[model samples]
Target: MTSRAVPPATAAVPVQDASLGAAVRLVRVSKTFPIAEGRALTAVDAVDLELAPGSLTALVGPSGSGKSTLLHLVGAIERADSGSLTVDGLDLVTANRRALTGYRRGVGFVFQRFHLLPALTALDNVLAPVLPDRRPGFDRVERARELFDAVGLAGREAALPSRLSGGQQQRVAIARALINRPRLLLADEPTGNLDSRTGRDVLDLLLDLRTRHPMTVVLSTHDPAIADMADHKVTLLDGRLASSSAPSAD
Candidate 1:
């Protein structure tokens, strides 16, 4: 008997855009950290960037190049010491705590390390984002189930992080990131922990998700191949924007 190969499942049809995806704009943005002495270390120098809504952008650079810092600034995880930042017309540099919280609710983050709870099952981990609310009307569990299935972890929801492989664990992380239905996704070296083949698969999954959601994705990576897949590329050097390129139309 001949074995038939099953094609990978595609993401579900996305809902209509509610203006969820946000365009990011940065002007002369800079951030610095104080060092041991009275001196300071600039993580991000004067940099200007513009990201269109619902676009995938790659941030590429070497170590200490400030790629991560730039992502954090956009996600509101880190504040810039100088300059201006605007996302979908909201000024991040001057946003208050309440505004920041609301803005973050519309953003998702995936880290280099799969930040899963060791003791929790895959399903529970995906539900972590909404677990604190304790709202009675929302069906977060159903949403979590759908996300797990979307990431190809349908039957493995009961498995713990310890029992899953590196790639599987990252899938769970991706599912968790989507639990909030975020419009902006920030991924910092998301494929850094997987093997080459597995990393490629993960990247494919990310691209697939982009098609199923109206979201802006900005991922930092050391891989040139990954950068090439993005619609736009931003390269950093010595904490400054070295160059940026947009894909040319055919």
Candidate 2:
């Protein structure tokens, strides 16, 4: 395992023409979890949201405000108990398990903790998504190297998670999320584990990557300053939407 020096910032390459990204629509979506003693707890309650394609939306709320649950519903990790949940015209609630599994592959998820396999090198970690089932016409290794370069780990391909700093680990995680070229990226508290400066750097990296990848990014965060950077803002309270702001014109 090796480490690489941070390269100087370079001009962003020309935006590649790719999929227009996925539009997310939720109509009265509700999700509940079974609790002990024959009881249930509502994680999301009749939440309605419309996220534009290729836009960045911030999910703002405190802990247990349904942010994570809402992301899970969109990612198809969890099903909605009632109401419609659709992404790019596919009905998530009615989709079968197989279909949902396929759907999950196309959607990328980033977590607060950098969930890298400590044993695998950075490049190998990025390649994990495609290892199970290779996609036709996709050069897995080539793509992995390209992503390493894109994420500023160009020379650190063999570096292990234990060798990288927090920021670098998160960058690797971001690269992993983009391995499939997903049209939608779901991030839950992406910056929560890093210090303020590093968190901002990670957030900026996400924004920059969105421009190049043409993907709609939805991230949940507790920091108001971080939320302010998004194109659109959605605030949740007690499993319900408290307010949703229109995308800023700027």
Residue pairs clashing in model 1 are none
- Model 2 per-residue lDDT tens digits across residues 63-116: 999999999999998999999998988899999999998899999999999899
Give the best candidate by lDDT: 2
Note each model's CA RMSD in angstroms.
8.8, 10.5
TM-score of every prediction relative to native: 0.89, 0.90
Question: Which stretches of model 2 miss by more than 4 angstroms?
Answer: 1-18, 131-137
Candidate 1 lDDT over residue span 125-227, tens digit each: 9988774667787788888888888888899999989999999999999999999988889999999998878988899999998788778899999888888
**What TM value does model 2 have?**
0.90
Model 1, which residues run further than 4 Å from truth?
Answer: 1-20, 131-137
Residue 123 lDDT (model 1): 90
